[model samples]
Target: MSAPEGPTFRELAVQALSSVQHGYDLLAPKFDHTGYRTPASVLDSVTGALRGLGPFGSGLDVCCGTGAGMGVLRQVCRERITGVDFSAGMLAEGRARTPVAPDAPRTDWVRADVRALPFGPVFDLAVSFGAFGHFLPRELPGLFAQVHSVLRPGGTFAFPIGAPARPGSRHYWELLAFDTAMRVRNALWRPRFVMYYRTFRLAEVREELLRAGFEVELRALEELGRRADGSPRCRLVVATRPV
Candidate 1:
């Protein structure tokens, strides 16, 4: 069957007003149809960069959403792969789409918040995509610590970070407008939908990772190319727990 169509503006409005889990549950079926799912190119670039670092025994996709990141983990991890998210609706949709294959890494789905992951140091790698914007800046340290705690010694927690939106671009204004609307929404609403496009700065993220005891390194996904100032257009942050 063909994938479902994307959500309309009213549908998106309803989603924005609901709590995050409920919003995602309502959005799950049409998520991939929207441009919101991690782009395939980003996924491939991340996979390519992580190839030599793994043969990873087990992997986790934190806030796994509809399981796009799990496909990347399935390629690299040898033993097990799991996707965890707080929304049952999203997990159900993911389970339906995910194919099971012989010799495929074992796959499991758990419904849990990333801030309070319920696992030991069992995974050799963990990843998240596009979900960081949901987390407030204050929550990042705890979130990073949770991911770090679930990873074995020397295990890597990796994710892609794009260069900040250029100040004069349409993309910049779009993000600025989105953030302003979110601020206004939060001020007027009881349960704020906590999505912001601008809060997850690379420098702030790097500092939080360090404070959470991760040793972080960044490698440009050069296939994505560089910006006008010679800075990379995109980079993958590989944060490792000490062995």
Candidate 2:
């Protein structure tokens, strides 16, 4: 995919050296310009898939950086939409850009950690996009449980999951090098920035959702096309908080 408009090299370097919260805050003004934002194609595919399941009441966008998922919720949820993340600057940028139509659900931007979301069983749907790499695998159970706790029984938490990069592929090596660099940087730095492309294993994530009391399902996103092996390039993982 093409890269989004983003920050400069020196700016990125400064952000990378800072703490995660501060780093994102520094990048927030130009975040949408960055490739870190979720792609419109993925968002559209999810919006299409969720349309069949919907006419939902309220929705939450977990770890919403710049409100792409919030826009998705606006299309489907009838009552309210909330975007939660710990980064104050990201929330500010999201609020500035993600305006609701007069006919759309009312929107709220919350600054809170996704691991400890501050909501009860009030939402009929929750979604996140392109935010999983920021979370370590070990924290997923608690994280999924937090999402589960905020959803009404039978509510769904959905996100796009791409096929793992094949070993020795260009993408695979790029991710490997990036993760290695991140590990080294974190080891030598204070207040680690936790992001690893390889850590969000689908099987492990499905198991964690199950342990969090979610019945999981995966639906191919046909719009994104297929891999060389004919498997879907990306699948939307829908985990329901069972009633």
Candidate 3:
């Protein structure tokens, strides 16, 4: 979960004791050292898929943590790119790390909560990476509605979703244990940290997206490879607002 430069156990423990926003603020400096940052391989795969779908005008990265998904937006979007998040520390780190050339597409960082995004139906494309677990199941309707509200007609909101771990598998047990631990911790602690591993299922997500006025489509991320049953290990969910 971490490299040599990542946070120590003590540091992580302290962060875990804080609210989700404050915890991320505490972790912002060393966030990239940990496994929480989305991998470049996943970003590249999404970029390739989106390149075919795009030449998009302006793009937004929803819940952009330290601007990893901004790389994907840069590759595919044409005019301007914006990243919005609730954490000031994370946004500051992103501004410091994300480079800009004189001729590069315009870049902007806005600090706002994703549940109530502050934007018009302006973006042609929007992408999020590995940040959905923070929201509970009941929040899906409002969350999807917020995303849908920010996309122009014919715009897309895209993200990757991994296949569930097979029952009885080691990975399955690991996730189950992690989620149970989180549940217990939230129950016992104040200022609950809302990160769980098992809540976002594809079928339920599709229903919510449709309810939010998106026409949903699922495409296999073939670059991520297939599982034992020949299903894709990861799939890209492309939800488009109607024109």
**Best candidate per lDDT, number?**
3
> How does candidate 2 score on lDDT?
0.91
lDDT of 1: 0.93
For each candidate, give its TM-score against the true structure: 0.97, 0.97, 0.99
Full-model lDDT, candidate 3: 0.95
In order, the Cα lDDT scores of the candidates are 0.93, 0.91, 0.95
Error of 3 at 55 (Å): 0.9
Model 3 Cα lDDT, one tens digit per residue, 49-118: 9998998999999999899999899889989999999999999999998786876689999999999898
Tens digit per residue, CA lDDT, model 1, 1-243: 113578888898899998888999999988888888998999999999989788799999999999999999999999999999999999999999988799899999999988999999999999999999999999998999999999999999999999999999999999999899999999999688999989999999999999999999999999899998999999999999999
Ten-residue stretch with the least lDDT total in model 1: 1-10
> Number of clashes in every candidate structure?
0, 1, 0
Expressed as tens digits, the lDDT of each residue in 1-243 for candidate 2 is 214467888889888888888899898988887778888999999999999999899999998988989989999999999999899999999999976478878899999988888888999999999889988888899999999999998899999999999999999999999999999999999888887889998899999999999999999999999988899999999999878
- Cα distance off (Å), candidate 1, residue 28: 0.6
TM-score of 2: 0.97
RMSD of candidates 1 onward, in order: 2.0, 1.4, 0.7
CA lDDT, candidate 1, residue 162:
98
